[model samples]
Target: MVATGKKLSLDLRVIELHTQTKLAGYIKLLQNNMRKLFFGSKINGVMALYC
Candidate 1:
């Protein structure tokens, strides 16, 4: 029973780390998308000026 408890604790730690990594990746993706959207709108506005 003690061994099982130890294994469960280790598994929880691994899961926590994985979740953090995933969350970080998701945040980065959102930042990148926002940057792209900001720049895209700027470019569109410039094109509209010419059109």
Candidate 2:
């Protein structure tokens, strides 16, 4: 019974780690897209001002 419990706990931990990694990857992608959008808007504004 103890061994089974331990195995279950390990499985849960692995699943948690996988979920966290996936979430982190998605967050990084969102941050990168946001950064690009921010810079793009700034560049557009500058161009508009110059024109």
Error of 1 at 17 (Å): 0.6
Report model 2's TM-score to 2 decimal places.
0.88
What is the number of residue pairs that collide in model 1?
0
Q: Alpha carbon lDDT of residue 2, candidate 2?
A: 100
Off by over 4 Å in 1: none
lDDT of 1 by residue, 1-51 (tens): 999999999999999999999999999999999999999999999999999
Q: What is the C-alpha RMSD of each candidate to the true structure, in Å?
A: 1.2, 0.9
Error of 2 at 3 (Å): 1.3
The C-alpha TM-scores of every prediction are 0.84, 0.88
Give the 10-residue window scoring lowest on summed lDDT in candidate 2. Answer: 35-44
